[model samples]
Target: MNEGIIEGFNRAQITDETLVKMRESSARDVDNLPIIRENSAALYRFLITALKPLCALETGTCRGYSAILAAKTAASYTDSFKCYTVELDSVNAQEAIKNIAAEGLTEHIKVIHGDAAEVLASLSGQFDIIFLDSSKSHYSEMLPDVKRLLRRGGVLIADDIAYYGKTEAGEVPHKHRTIVNSLRAFIRQISEDEDFTAVIDTMDDGMLLAVKN
Candidate 1:
């Protein structure tokens, strides 16, 4: 297989100097943390900038890489844009807060420390974008709340859905069967729902980007 051509064609639509730093910083913990893929991060910056969302929500706050990128992009459009990200682990949340501050996005990005379900339930404002990058097993469970919080025409982006490039509904590793099944179900629900227009972007790790009707 010619992987070179594949890489050449998956070009990024936008670029930012901070992205390289964030990518390098997060790469340090790639073994333990699920940091955003290079291509994924580029695409995220592109989409968020294009969307210019006034308010956004993200489920994962791993070291605040993606959250900071999102805040940077949103802030470029308007100073009032706000980003609220949820982190289930207290330690990760604390680290994310520090990183957000270091990036000088403390005013634009807010890290909420708690379970995604609980944090999402308490959220009061409708968002122009929602990002799902937390527990794979809970993506399905969190879809209802995501839908409730996402405004019409808003974007819902989920990462790592096509785990290890395996998205088909069938056999999976014993330990990962539940997560795979849940992801498959979530895909089906979003794809079949009349209110959404969704597609799976096979860039690097699989990304599911859907727009609410």
Candidate 2:
């Protein structure tokens, strides 16, 4: 976590010290992988605390940081909360399982190793909250299943929509153009869709939040 964001979270009293320390430790453990940004994590914490979701789903489980955070936060409000997180890489999935176990949240957070789209397609039951943090290019492709699996009043959060600012940049580099275009399309689809009330939070890289109506 960034020192500045940590300070802001402390001042706002959005998260407890324990979770903050866990985020810091997870960062050190997975220094090479991209974990959830501090600002984004705070946003997620706030939403989970407010929603008190009984069932949650996450598309990316780099080291189970976000899943653990959500599960712990939801545990405060409900005893029946369960979170299912998917990771495509087997190595990351194993690391996520280990991390969740270290947090003593193995019972609440389930780590599945498989392609996100395939897993989402196979999943049944509606989720109260759905977090999409997988490949930016596949977001649009996965929206259908995401919508189907989210309950009518569920919240859908898509992280890294800005893709290091390239999605909204006036001139995107050639290498990033494909993902930028894909993210923009995903944003447009969610923003224009009548079923959802959507907005983009320009914090961290950027997060697209939508509520299914």
Candidate 3:
């Protein structure tokens, strides 16, 4: 976590004390599932503030940190805000529910327990913002549903697109080849798609931000 970036955003400008504490607490998770990095979380909070999205969808709700952040931030701007976050792991999903409750955002954020792709397929309404941060290999496979669920002019944010720099560096190790290749394919697919105007942010791993045209 960069103190300079935090100071630049200004804690008061981005989020409240409780959420900040939550972020810090979640940083020490025992299972070591990747939580959103500070810079990436800041970017998310900034986007939610800027966009004021009423309905946001998030995949990969690991302990509900990002979803809670989004819900709380959006709540500052609009009463209509609601976030639906999906998690595949039952234990993670339960933890997310508890964390959301702890944040007093249970009404604003829903933690759905299921496979991300299947859950996306079952969801019916359009989302103003859709975030993809689930399994790396599943990203490309989930694109069709993501495209379908996001409304026109909605924002799509995909995290960990660089696979910790493995996607860009030469000679990906054998074990990482699948994820690296999938992330590269996902990047290419979004970049070449006619309907989206996209850009990659290389801070804290990598994030792909695209607007549906």
Best by lDDT: 3
- List, residue by residue over 29-110, the lDDT tens digit for candidate 2: 6565577887887888889998889999999898787888888788888877899999999888998888788878888999
Cα distance off (Å), candidate 2, residue 132: 0.4
Question: Which window of ten consecutive residues has the lowest lDDT sum in model 3?
Answer: 5-14
Candidate lDDT values, in order:
0.84, 0.86, 0.87
Tens digit per residue, CA lDDT, model 3, 114-184: 99999998888899999998998989988989999999999999998988789886888899999998888
Error of 1 at 128 (Å): 0.1
User: Per-residue error at 149 for model 3, in Å?
Assistant: 0.5
Task: Give lDDT: candidate 2, residue 151.
Answer: 99
- Residues 131-178, candidate 1, lDDT per residue (tens digit)? 999988899888988999999999999998899866665678898888
* Model 3 residue pairs with clashes: none
Candidate 3 to truth, TM? 0.91
Task: Judge candidate 2 against the unseen true structure and give its global Cα lDDT, from 0 to 1.
Answer: 0.86
Report RMSD (Å) for each prediction in the order shown.
2.7, 2.5, 2.2
